[model samples]
Target: MANAQLFKSMQQSQPLPAALARNAEGTPAYALTPRHQLAQYAATGCLNATFYASAEAQLATVLELCKAVEPSFIAQTAVYCRERGYMKDMPALLVAVLAGQGAAEFAPAFQRVINNGKMLRNFVQIMRSGAVGRKSLGSRPKKLVQAWLNSASEQALLAAAVGNSPSLADVVKMVHPKPKDAWRAAFFAWLIGREYIAADLPPVLAAFETYKLDPAQTIPDVPFQMLTALPLGAQDWAQIARQGGWQMVRMNLNTFARHGVYAIEGMPELIAARLRDPASIAQARVFPYQLMSAYMAAGENVPTVIRDALEQALETSLLNVPRIAGKVVVCPDVSGSMSSPVSGFRGSATSNVRCIDVAALVAAAMLRKNPDAMVLPFEHSVVTCRLDAHDSVMENAARLAAIGGGGTSCSAPLLRMNSKQELADLVIYVSDNESWIDAKRSGATATLGQWNVFKQRNPQARLVCIDISPHATTQAMEREDILNIGGFSDDVFKIIAAFAAGQLDPEHWVGEIAAIDIAAGC
Candidate 1:
């Protein structure tokens, strides 16, 4: 048959059809291996595209575009682009095609490769929830529709986001900007107010009166007001600062105790032993940590051994406020003890700095009920970026990867934004208890934007402090003013519940574990 001969002839010209081929399954003669082929195709574009020229290709492979060409191609393409910031239409069009965005208007060079390049799917993933600047990247037509609609899962949203369809209205509603129900009501209320204004002017806008307006504020910023309620605690993390040629370390054992491990117990000893002398453990060279963290929320029934073992986990586990809204507002202690090796990726001389991941969870908890709620991060000045889950397939991925450690100067940025009154409903600041006042030079860093104006009324702006410094104890926490969130999810949620209920006070938070069964994922 002609088909059989074509398949045979294709193999003769191409190599033995390695697993890394872009259209392996479409080739019909050999099996397709995803990982191996992705790694290979990434290095060279020689993988033929003829086999995947149309939906007919999936008839043979059947794998969704997400599973097949999503990361495998995105990684290579992004890496390539990073190497060259911007190029001719070819590179950008290549990414547009592989990302699942439309590519019809692209140059012939890109069209030539669209068959197997697999860029369409990747582009779709990045711009699922109405990304800020997706329209400029060529024609992002929604090519696939009916195959996956009802299931507005992360992957589903990404696919639907870039595709073109009248059915997309429902899909867009499913992936709108409201952060939670509270946020929707808040936004809806604003819509009604707008409607009232319009009805007073235009005749066509009269029908808008029927829609009920809900008034509520959805997004909350840094929990600045909650800082007073932070549980009074012993210090946990240590800080190191370099002046000229000397490095000094500041350690807090009380915070470690608050973390639940007494200094005399084997836990503290174990941690001390590891840090003081690492050659011993490295000599064994195990695959993973030999011990499960005792820092788990074991409550009163928790075994003494585990309670003892938990002492060492306190360094990173203390003051951990698990689960926030969409994103937790984090300001790294990029000063004395928190400096990174200045020469590596992003800004690093080394990668030994500590990152505060709990703030995002607290922000997420705040925004969990809103579709548009988000947290803003800042240093000397506040960074204006807000994170949203609908913006990506798994909002959690972005949450987990929000790692930044640098010297922090709070005044410059906070003052800048305060002048503009762009502050959110709530604001929370996480730090190691070291203090800085008005450290801004000429450049503005963090802008509070009206926080000072609203401070009298919303003093407890959901602010929580993670006292990583033992010496920082008396400084940052001024009574039960800031909600104290230790670096433990089990207790962190408890503290949040208490704060929400107006009960996260120093008198009630005894550092005791909860008796109820803890969730599996937590």
Candidate 2:
């Protein structure tokens, strides 16, 4: 007979490399490269209080990571997060760090990342907070701010003036942008409370000033906040609702209903039509989870038609979720920490969307696209969640999110799969990546151990870990067969599809960031 040792399973699992550090959960985990850490935080960090990290701790970690990586990498990561990941706070923070470093890429990165007034304000606030390094908007950043102010259209500027405590008006005061024309000069003067000819103001501003003085005028097509203080009737509020953009409409459904917009003839149908418009949804870059947030936040007064429209828009937004060609397993982490808001706690400003909501949405969308996919909701163990292929994605997501709230064991599902000899072409995990329940002190993470066993049976299987929180460690090391990505944007689905088709290198998420053309004109 052949020697038993020689004939034994050649695929016996080997010990993994020693963990480089501990995760937020105080468990042994691999440390990400500086660039990878920066990318992870940039994509998912909101600079708020996460379950595992405080706002102060997150800020310090981000600054340290920025120092370790090349300034250019920071710039690229900022652009990648803002443009592709559709993140807001973290990208602005990265750009602020670049400004502090005085890198050559700062100007272009600022121009690209600070695309809107809110973002510009964020960058200015971060600079002035002295968190990154400087406490003042130095000459370069001030110049860019001035340029941004000069370049914005009159309507855009008016909309930008809605927020306060360093609002657009405050930014104008800081930058003292030189006016290019008489209208701008008059507008700047009016913005800062200096006297100016009202007629010289841009059309929208002129209309706004007139409307403010007399509530009888047709509500100006300015931001809704600008009109909220005016004494207006239901019809006036209806007109404002009619003029609101897609995002504005989605966010203020309850407000619109409260203001009697739905009571107006034909208003509900028109708004419903707008809500379901595919082109507008794509242009707005609306995430499915965002629509889910809107849907859940809508009050009883919100129109049924509008509620149906939100569901339709959610489906339209997820049109890019790929239908994989083979067996797929989606394991969503339903641990207790996932109950915290997706954007982290920021007092009253925290998002209503929870991390688990996004994970469940992703898993549900995948199941909808691939009707044969298996969904396993896990915390310390595989929690059974029954989902139907034909059920609405939102309903299925709610079901999956309702199950587990125990300690995280990222290895639980994989171990279950190994025991059952499950075959899968792709194993997807949507989690915070703070696994600790099954962590090892001197060997590979239990996740890696189980994955190795699963790989022995299916050599070509690929694992995709979609982290939805801001953290700097992972359960499994990145390799040719593994991908670690962050963020809740639907763009993630496209990236997953490309990776599953072998269109990306092992560098995966970081390679995508590294490939950004930072030198390209903004």
Candidate 3:
């Protein structure tokens, strides 16, 4: 096909932009349905918020999606507001909550929350909730409290908060200052508020107590306890692991890994136990990669025992993959361009995982679960994947990553199939969608032309293009049989199964939530 003819065919395909496409009613149509909004957020697999094109546009889409599940969304409102910098546009009560969560750099935004008279009652309400605070303020919790304490309205807010919930005494105690160069009042106040085991108090606290007892007291030299009390040591971590449930244990372990402290005693056994637990296995499936990635980022020696457990757990978890019975050819594009990081938000050490890795993971899952499937690692041409049922997801991912990273040719699979006179029930291409095919590369047949020829050769074959990145358009998406999907989720298999069964529409899955009302709040 000529470039002109290829362009014409793409126009007929009605290619939908992955994230911001709208419906006939002019409401936001998310590629995944509104119900999967949180999953979409989690699917980013990292916390860095710069993954999307613009924060404003992303938040707008999120807010619109929240309308589908308003109450649950309301509960997480504070988190999104702080995490995404949506503070300025939030309702006054939410803004006030953010003020308490505090980062000193957002002092200007805090001032706006403080000055809103109508929000005072809501502010007081949040203070009285006694909820464990979020990291909205970054490293400025003390500064936040001080700013509030300096206000003329401080007494009223504090009184109201303490009156409603006495638990805030600890925060208030920490926030207030005593006489110049003295912290006696604050120290005792904090001490009285909580019960502490004798060994748990760090060496610095004993020296502080001695100093208080006598002005002549020789204070022993000790490392100062920074920000959040003493740093969590091996003993503290063991106690934390013993105290919390599986989820809590996993979170604590991950936090430790993030801080470059991974030698905690009993962590390996604890992690293994969680992986094997029936209750923990479901959440384990999605999070083990993230946790392992964290450990890898820390440059810690990841024990083979831990790695094997995660792989086993993922296999156990994916056994629930809605079985799609068919001869399917899974092609993951391993072009060098696919090595680009999926998100702009990732910084340094932890961000090296690329789009090709994501595609390979997906393809591996499909190949491992479905016995009738074949995987091909493709660049400018197609080559067979040496994937066996025994190959782990990471192992297959490594195989794909090792393939030649040259130019992209989305039509490679189709060309291979047509030449070999092969047939499949379905053909899935996992790619970044920068095909940019010319006659020199594709040899007279562009991606669409190759697909058309493949269709004639195997009329029963279905074409599925799973765009792992958010590309604006993809070749062959305009056709009725060609189903285009976007985003990163294992749940995508369920969508594929449903589409194969003719029980769901791919365009509908890729488009906005049809059931959502654009004007319900209006």
Candidate 4:
């Protein structure tokens, strides 16, 4: 019983390698190790996968002894016991599929580990030359292996992976070794045929080539509105609604009196009599986030480069005026992998709220451009506060709520940002880019350039990526250097941080696709 199926595949772990815990601890690890016969073949014990007479001769005897094993039981099994073939290891499955587990649930044990393929093509060129996720990357592949290398099936490869439109060569053979599947005919001749960040992605996701002999009981659950639908044009759909945004200045007041009353008074024929019967549009978009937070007023020329990115984020706030320094961590993301539901309000009781929190309550008014700033709350990670750093991160995120939700973690609050870097050492992460930072970092180096960890342990730090979904107008026409912060109005987020600081070249304007009604609203 080959050591009781190697101890029933190391106590039912399924994904096992590092030479079955360094050759069952006799100190024989993975990757071409001197490993003395992998500690007498993982201490024999009588191999287990429940006495494999079948699971296809126990995964073809773990991929024919992981293709003539040696580099110590081929990296010593783990990705669910080397994708069920008992752990054909390659330096412990290349440090567990470059730590992001590339395509887990035993990604077809990436087919006997690509039999000598540049460790799955240099782990997709070190996560597509982005150099692994940046708030200092080290957070394991928590973001579903960076959403399987930014998906792509078609919609013109999710509109050229978000530079908006262009992906064909028959949708680049469904996301092959990718660079939008090798510039699909120079991005479908640069989309002269509209391409909104298309996405269908499923071509052997993270390469596996197939052969371990039947074990894939089926998987591939990818639906976040099909990779956040990316197509736009006609002057970038009127600058995503001339940046005044939110469905291009969405104002519906059949009765806006607010904090005083009238709250959608009868609510658009009570939402056309509850959408002609039942009851829920989240109770009819809860009177449009309460009349868009009571007709949100305040905007006078917020330009001087967004008053210098709110005075360089209020001179890295050690706090001043209205009592200085510390506390503003509003981390609310009710997980269970965020089960989407929210549509339009007050009903049978439900709210998966993520319409991009109307751009996180309009970027938490950038903590009134900084003063005591705090909003503490989180999911999948950070959620514990005894309430002190002098209170008020919006009065302790109004005792922030969380019934529970899962899957979302970015290095679980590295000891609360290294024990509060003197009043928030600049962290302005706002998601909906569908989080991703597939791990790896040690003596860092790799740049699109944005460095600043000064006392944070630099990896070219300066960081800031605020993509409020609708794929930030296809990642601002496809990354000339990534800044994408389009409008939800505080005068369209101070002209989207001065059109993301090229000082604003909104190309004299004319774009809005509020779900197309006949066409172009002047």
lDDT tens digits, residue span 171-265, model 2: 99898999888798888898889999877898888988888888777888999897777677789878887899999989988888888888899
**Residue 372 displacement in candidate 2 (angstroms):** 0.6
Model 4 scores a TM of: 0.19
| TM agreement with the true structure for every prediction | 0.29, 0.97, 0.57, 0.19
Worst 10 residues of 1 by lDDT: 240-249
Worst window of 10 by summed lDDT in candidate 2: 6-15
What lDDT does candidate 1 reach at residue 256? 40
Q: Please, what are the lDDT tens digits per residue for candidate 4 over residues 217-288?
A: 222122112222433222322222222222112221211112111222332233223222212322222222
User: Which sections of candidate 3 miss by over 4 Å?
Assistant: 1-228, 243-267, 283-300, 437-445, 516-522
TM-score-based ranking = 2, 3, 1, 4
Cα displacement (angstroms), candidate 1, residue 479, comes to 3.6
Q: Looking at model 4, which ten-residue stretch has the lowest summed lDDT?
A: 508-517
Candidate 2 matches the true fold with a TM-score of: 0.97
Runs of candidate 2 exceeding 4 Å displacement? 1-13
CA shift of 79, model 4, Å: 13
Best by TM-score: 2
Clashes of 1: 109
Local distance difference test scores for all models: 0.31, 0.89, 0.52, 0.30
